[model samples]
Target: MAERVYPKLIGARLRGQTSYRASFALQCVSSGLGQLVELGVILILFGRVTSLGGFSVTEVVLMYAIAGVGFGLADMVAGQLDELPAHIRTGTFDVVLMRPLGTLAQVMASDVHLRKIGRIVASLVALVWALAHNDIAWSPATALLVVLAPLSGAVIFSSIWVVANAVCFWLVEGQELANAVTYGSGSFTSYPATVYGPWLRRFFAFVVPGSFVAYYPGLALLGRPDPLGGPALLGWVSPLVAVATAAVAGLVWRFAVRHYRGTGS
Candidate 1:
């Protein structure tokens, strides 16, 4: 059912945005430029430093593009949950509950923000450049991983975004922190996860598990060993991590819905 419904919802959104073609195009351009500028920062830094942690510039770019694609995908979909506060405040969410559709699906499908396609485009550009610049030994596993990494990461990011929006049920004011966690996870995962201190790395890896999506897989993919200690096997754990986080998010959402009382707006 989701497979059938999601595309139609997104298509409707695309048509709506298409009505204002110029505005949509500009947003896409700006998003691409923003990603490019970030890539420039990494390039400039690499000019002075040969590598970060144990990974070289090209390998890092691969990690960046992977995480970028993941988050861009999530932001294009679940990032719509950022508006939950407005929905609750204005009593719009009451209608959401009254509808026959699943509340989570409705919330995610509410805004098919096409502007994020720019970030995805930029990620693809960076990904192609990285592949060209770095000579990664390609094999069946690596080929499969390339598809799995971003896909698993996108699901993880969307789950985190859902959890963040679920908090709006009670803590109506602290939305920025949730937004930070969503966008910041992208930044945190884009680089070598081992570069950070043990505590910070543990927080993202065990607590949030963002590192599993790209950084660990990146190490395995690039054939570089992890500097901070852990089983290298964790690299392939993206699917498991995605399942865990998403399950937790689902439980939290269920709890939130039960506790909800109409805002009376």
Candidate 2:
């Protein structure tokens, strides 16, 4: 049954990941330190001014924390998409297709990095710091949205990675450029969307849905006014964006798999 299969695959991955303790530990530390360094930039920017592009230090940090944990969770699971090109290039994708498991689930569960816990922890610390200073009303709905935001964020990011990697089926050499969507957007969502021009913001909002991944959901959570002056209600659309993105990605991935005629390697 799928219930038993998913856990067995993921558990096996966790065990294999833990087999190399030193490497795992180093990655964890580095992941934490890297996030701190990004936070340091925000702190330094705030030291010079009250806010950046209308987002206060706490707000910006909150945005970063929400985005970081969301992206980190996505990366820990679906980062294997990055290796899809390699799988196809090496003719291993054929083997993957032959397996009893679903290709998407198998690829998603393939690279479960425990080091991403470092990024999650760093985000948690920042969230705590942000909550310490904010005047948020802890209403029941607010509580529910706060809980929903990060989980939806994970799905949003995972879908981005999935759709981007599906290109590997068409481009045999692989598209190294897909990082601009996944990794690049992770960096982009940490700041308020207002800092960018209408074109850039629209591209992210309409095309990639990066706005829903963190910025918009964050706007609603903090009860802060949108810098671009959109309806505050846009924040609630984050879950819809996540679901829609995943649906499209699933369709693309399935179509790509159907079309993949392995290179005569």
Candidate 3:
């Protein structure tokens, strides 16, 4: 039942957005351009230096592409969770709760912004360009990692969105905090983990685990050894990290939902 219903829900939202064709197109262009600007910054920086933290311009672009696509997809799908506080404040959450669908499912499917695909498209182009420019040893494993890396990164990012936004159930004003963590993770993961200081790298790696989103998989894709001396096998552990993060997010979300007592308005 959910299999059919979720698609219908998403389809309805997609149709509504497409109804404003010109606006939709403009929004997509704007979104893609904005994302490209970030990539441009990396290129400009590399113009002055040959390498950053032992990574070339192309290698850093690979990281950016993976992280950008992951975050873009997550933002399109689960970013609506940021509005949970507004729904709670306006008492519309009661209506959401009365629906037959799972709260998270309905909330996620409520607003599917197709404009965010622009960011994904921009990053995908970069991914192809990076793959072409890099010295990759093509193999069955390498091919599989290339395909799975972005997807696993998406799951990792989406789980971060869920866990961070779940705080809204307790602190309706927690959106800023959640945005800091979620968007911050995206920004942090857009470069090689080696670029950052050890403390920042460790924080993201252990506390938030954003490193799994791009940096590790990127190492595997590029056939580069970890500059930090971590095992090469860590590159392939993104799927495991994504699954673990998602499980933890599920628990936090459920706990938050159960603790909700409404605003009593």
Give the number of the best model, judged by TM-score.
3
Per-residue lDDT of candidate 3, residues 49-135 (tens digit): 999889999999998999999989998998898898898888899898897778899999999978999999999999999999999
TM-score of each: 0.94, 0.95, 0.97
Q: What is the per-residue lDDT of model 2 for residues 1-265, given as tens digits with 9 covering 90 to 100? A: 7679889988998988788999888888898888889989989988899978788788888788888889888888888788988888989889889988789988877768778888888887887787678778788987788777888889989999998889889987656777778887788888889878899899888898888877888888888788787899889888888899999999999999999999878
User: In model 1, what is the error at residue 112, expressed in angstroms?
Assistant: 0.4
Compare the candidates by lDDT and give the number of the best one: 3
For candidate 3, give the lDDT of residue 26.
Answer: 94
Order of candidate numbers by TM-score, starting with the best: 3, 2, 1
List residue ranges in candidate 3 displaced over 4 A.
none
> CA lDDT of 71 in candidate 3?
89
In order, the Cα lDDT scores of the candidates are 0.87, 0.85, 0.92
In terms of lDDT, the poorest run of 10 residues in model 1 is 223-232
Stretches of candidate 1 exceeding 4 Å from the true structure: 1-7
Record all residue pairs in model 1 with backbone atoms less than 3 Å apart, i.e. clashing. Answer: none
Q: In model 3, which range of ten residues has the least summed lDDT?
A: 256-265
Ranking by lDDT: 3, 1, 2
